[model samples]
Target: MNRWLVPALALALIAASAASLLAGTVWLRPQDVLAAIAHPSDDLPGLIVLQIRLPRVLLAMMIGGILGLSGAVLQGLLRNPLAEPGLLGVSAGASLGAVIAIYYGFSASFSLASPLFGLAGGFVTASVAFLLARGGGTLALILAGSAVTAIAAAGTEVALNLAPNPYAAYEIMNWLMGSLADRGWDHVRLAAPFIVAGGALLLATGPALDVLALGETQAESLGVAVGRMRLIALIGTALGVGAATAVAGAIGFVGLVAPHVVRPLVHHQPGRLLLPSALTGALIVVLADTATRVMRLGGPPINLGVLISLVGAPFFLWLVLHVRTRTA
Candidate 1:
């Protein structure tokens, strides 16, 4: 696959996201959107088009892009088609952190603190799982991740139950559902740097990931720094996922499914798949977010996470059965 194609696809998704932002609520024509973007004070439509929708659309691009890239990384590293950021309990851990922050009212003190804590939680979980899986390779990592996920999820539930205020549960519930509504530049600003940094790290490790495909002993024999490469990839995942989960609040399936969706486009070449997966992830999230805004359920906005899980959970179960049968 031509590398240029990935960027082109990402750009197209971004354009679509932008269009979706303006189209659904008010049905702004493309020319009017362009005009509104160009000149800020034409009318209420112009203002709403530029101010309200554009930022959200851009945020969707960033979150989706990050999830896609990280998903590709996780899949490549674990050598499992089923691997996702959530698979290793990183997303759950981040959610736990965010939940704690929200429950304790830290979010009010510092809006950015929620995500920072979430990022920290993601990193700790991924690192721990990575370490547990380190010596034994893929199987060990999967087991450790599973264990961690169970533990973290239990912890999150406990925190939710123990919340001081009853309304805290509602707030936590909303956050967990992963909406892009009411998010502003503060979120973008908080998440962008970490995502960019993490993305850079992942991109830099592409050559190493290619080597890793050859098996650990083979990779090490070929002058690949397996340990360091794993560390770098883990850090990249932490930053990328942490930032994304911080802002998006555990939007599932993008990491798990995006790589699978794009793998064929890259001919199953790990390195080639990375960018395309990223683009596909971006497309999925942006499209889902757009749908969330436009698609109403009984008069309120629907939850994006529920929508994804409804679709993904069945696929995930089928995947599990398929993997087991094949292994058997």
Candidate 2:
């Protein structure tokens, strides 16, 4: 990790956030944005900036950062460069919980209930996934995660099929597509504490991860319990990613992409890669969302989730090809 990367990432996050705040439908100057944040007023621009755009912007950044941190931790846990929370089915598990909340109408009663169920779903599935493939390597974990994701997806679809009202199902479907548009401070408040705390938990495992990189036997000899470390990583990933999916739906590939982009910059040190990956993830999402708004200027609005998938899905294939070539 270069001494300067964290500060640089911080700067980039700030720049991206600023760009997002200014890029919306209502034009607000930099000064206007500053005044809107620093001063309270009863004007439309002020209301738009403070109430509508700010929460969306913050949530995008936070969700991206959470995904990034989770990705890095999972990669470190599995000791596989290609490992990611979504690819490992953690995000899908969380989304399953959110779907259940929506189906059962728990979300109708309390705004926070959905996220809590999401957190629990992710936690349980992650634990179960690892336990199901205990003593198996990265490939086993990947296979287990694929199975978990498929089951969750099927369950969600079944619920949607059985939804009592067409309108309710339609709303749930739209929410699943993911967008920061029209989000409020309530969303930000809902996800921030869990994200920050969960990210911290993941990052805290850096030393254990570094040790485990030496191989499980070596780490165990050094008093690092491999099982415990893996559990911690899963819990951290579940908390952060579950909260994010709860609030923003499943925004894919931020995790898979962020750490890879930051690894070389950080000299491939897993411990050092955490913060930069998180910051870069924040940057990726802020910009993706900004692009979404820009494209919407001339066409039907595109969802942020769809935009990231279009871009990331290709990148994922390229990565898979590259990895295969190297391994072969």
Candidate 3:
């Protein structure tokens, strides 16, 4: 890894965060932003910067960082270049949970209902996957996760189908599309602890991940508890990605794309890839959210998750072609 790579990523994240604060429906100059931040007044600029954009930026950083870190860890753990947090069904479960909250009118009466349900759904589905895959290896875990994801997705679709009104269905679909728009400090408070804890857990597995790259038998021979490590990774991913989906709807692709973007910079070392991937993920999501604010497509800004998918789907195709060419 280059000595400067981490620092460079950090600098980029800082710049992205700044851009997130400044870019919105009503753009504010740097001077205005600084003034708002420093004074914390009741003025429109202050309210916009302090109350609206700041929390959204913070949530973007946390969610993106956790997704990236977890993606790197999952890739390393499974020895699969394409592995990501959602492979474990956490995101789907969370989405299902939130959808249920909305479908049942719980979210209408309680502001925290959706997120809380999302967290529970994520945890339960992840636990089911883990248990079903126990005593089996990586392949089993992947299969179990896929099954769970399918089930949860089906449940979500059923909720939509059974919705009493078109308005309810539209609301569910819009939430599923995902966005950081209108997010506030409450969301930050809700997701921050889980993201932080999950990130720490993922980061702690770095050395083990590097060892596991040599193969599971060799990793075990080196005194790495492969099963325990797998458990930790799964739990970390569920906590972080679950909370993110809970609050932000079903944002995707950050986990899938971040690690791949940073892998080369880190010389393809799993251990070193973690932090840089996290920073890059934060930068990507923050920039994407900022773009969502600025790029009004006639009627309204694009959903954050939708924009990421639009970019990521093409990148994913390119990756497939590149990999095929290399292996051919």
State which candidate has the highest lDDT.
3
lDDT of 2 by residue, 1-328 (tens): 4889999899989998998888866777889888988896868778978898888889999899988888988888788877877765677877788878888888889876667777777777777788876887656777888898888888878878998899669767866787777678988887888888888889898888778778878989999887777767766777788788878888888898888878878777788888899998889899999888878646668888889999988987887787578669
What lDDT, from 0 to 1, does candidate 1 have? 0.80
Clashes of each: 0, 0, 0
Give each model a TM-score: 0.87, 0.88, 0.97
Per-residue lDDT of model 1, residues 241-323, tens digit only: 87888777989888888887667567678877878888888888788888877776776777777777777678767766875
| Candidate of highest TM-score | 3
Using lDDT, rank the candidates from best to worst: 3, 2, 1
Between candidates 2 and 3, name the one with more favorable lDDT.
Answer: 3
| Over 4 Å off, model 3 | 320-328
lDDT over C-alpha atoms for residue 209 of model 1: 78
Q: How many collisions between residues are there in candidate 1?
A: 0
